[model samples]
Target: MDLYIFCRMVLQQKALILLVTVVVAALASAYAFLVRPEYQVSSVLRPAAINELDALNRSEIYQLPSGDALIKVGASLESYETRLGFFRANQKLFKNFERPGRTLEQSFEEFNYNSIKLVVPDAKNAGSLNAYIKLVMNYPEGVAGVAILNGFVQYAIESQRQQIAADMEVIVRNRLSELAGRLDSARSSYVTDKAAKIAKLTEEDNLKRAQLQDELKALRAQLKNQRADQIAQLNEAIGIAKSLGIQKPSTPSSLGGAGVQGSQPVMRTEVNNQQIPLYFMGVDALLAERAALLQRKSDDFTEARIAQIAKELQLLQANREVEVLNQRKNEDLFLSGVQPLRAEEVRLRNLNVDMSGLKLVTIDKKAIDPLGPVKPKKMLLIIIGIVFGLMLGLVAAFVRGTDQSRRENSSDTTLLPHSSIPAKKALLSNVEAL
Candidate 1:
């Protein structure tokens, strides 16, 4: 293993080494020319950054911008699923193209391991949120190789755009669906509450109307009795005047309760702790006139007093009905503001329109056919072969020399049979002389 001894052995076997080196050189030349070479084409792409997606995400569904999402998209372009999709989509193209085997699956696998490659830059090291994607493809030397990369460029760009757009739309729809459900619940609650309040108001108004009607009938009866009593009083006064032949009664007669009724006070209602008063001035005036007419006994006075009493009762009944309706009107709140929520529903529905047509990625550079083949390094291979061949030659020489020395030491005769004994001895003598 020492340098001097090894050098001596190699020099002694220089002829064998030269032959092996020449043979290796010829083989390497053949390989360089005969083996098929591969041509590579590459395309650069710019993926949508998280910020870019966020800008397009009007629904605010995505949590944040993610460089990793872009990176994954790039990586998926090289995946089996995506490649299979390309193959299936371009079945006509694949049918006409050269394949390694009969099945499309075989051809697809060949393209997967050997032809297609992805070079996605690490976003973490790039000091940028978005990293660019590069795709490299190596194909067997032919025009088809160029076409393959060209087609792939389109497939990748289109697929990535579609993928990103679809993802965004899905997220938007999910967010919209949640919002829609919540809005529906709120609307339902509003509608139910409005209906309940309206029903309660109607019932309360009905009760108030019934109570007012009962009170009006009672007032009518009281007024009828008063009218009958007043008519009798007027008749009695007339009888006294006729019998005594006097123009006026000698005794000043009490007008019963007509004076008390003349001071007509309006009723006041209590609403939410506030008192609201309703006045009946017409009833007060009519009662005062009736009382003055009742003091006389003439025919005209009797007729006028009865007419005034009837008019006062009618006005009182009408005023009571108005008070009942006014109370119902004052307690309305729910139905007055019911349109705003409905308008919001309309707005949200319109906000959920189509957003599927957005573009998420753009192609920066397309794949182009390389001017020359990318593989088969002729000079480098030739150098390696020459070195390997010389080592083989040296090893062969050492083995042959060792076999010869063993034969000479172990055998009493020459290494050849007895017929070559003289020649073998002559060869040994020549070596000794040298």
Candidate 2:
């Protein structure tokens, strides 16, 4: 009830309190010194750019590169199978460092699945590569813990490297093959287009040349007509000279001069009266005939005029021939179609064959030994044990005190029956207070 009374009661049961305190203290000390200490060795391993164009290399046309791949690496390192296999692979080391009361396989399994922890640090920034992979290994031995964590990290990195390389090689090879196929097919089509264009242009040229030939023939016929006229005029002039009793001219050889049109007039009589006038036809017949003679004229062009016409005709024929030749040459130069474009497309496709790259990349942080054990804080446990021992000892003392008080009251009731009521009431109050 009061401090002094409680102290007096505890003093009466000092032996029991002291025994409980000693037992609790001894148990605490045993636990502090005997249990094996546990250490937590932690390390970080984040994915780093493996190449200069790591982002470009890993990216595809429509896909986002996954930082989750790095997370997978971290997770695989803490898997039960991986840890168990690692322990089994190094049996002697595992036996030496593994925790007690479990087989090596079981011990490593628990260590990986239960004790080891994974953390994605800075997870709020998961949209990018802001997250870091944190791996923690909890074990009884600090050096072994660090070694095991490092080993797992190496395995994970290698696995990621292999996976990335294989995948990228497949993609690149497929893309390269596709490019080659397209370029080859395009080039073949280009060749075919070129041949077709050449054929078309040649056909058009041949047709044009044929038309030119026809034009030349017609122009030549026009030139021939002019020549024939010139020849005929030369013959007519020679015949006229012969009729005048002049010596025959030398045989005509060239038709270089112009053409002449000749019109001859014949004699005709016009009767004026029934009697012929003596003055008109009498012995002065010569004079009368002269008066009656009709003026005979020929309708003929001058040589100069014929020559001018011939030259103009010749000029027109030459101009037509020249124009036809020019048209054929111009139309045959190039095809206005798909061949040129196909050739250019082939060139562009060929240019894409040169770009290539490597695929997998990795970087890691090494695991380091922990500064001290993580568990079994000896100084802290000793302090806790002191407080625990005091409380337990006080509880034992109170229980002993209550039992002793009840025994004393029972003995008083038996020895003095008349004062039992008052004594029992006082006893009840004392028990209540206790």
Q: Top model by lDDT, which number?
A: 1
Model 1 worst lDDT window (10 residues)? 275-284
Kindly list the per-residue Cα lDDT of model 1 for residues 290-313, writing each as its tens digit: 576565443423344445545554
Query: Where does model 2 exceed 4 Å of error?
Result: 45-109, 120-133, 141-143, 205-365, 417-428, 431-434
N/CA/C clash count, model 1: 0
| TM-scores, one per candidate | 0.60, 0.55
lDDT of 1: 0.61
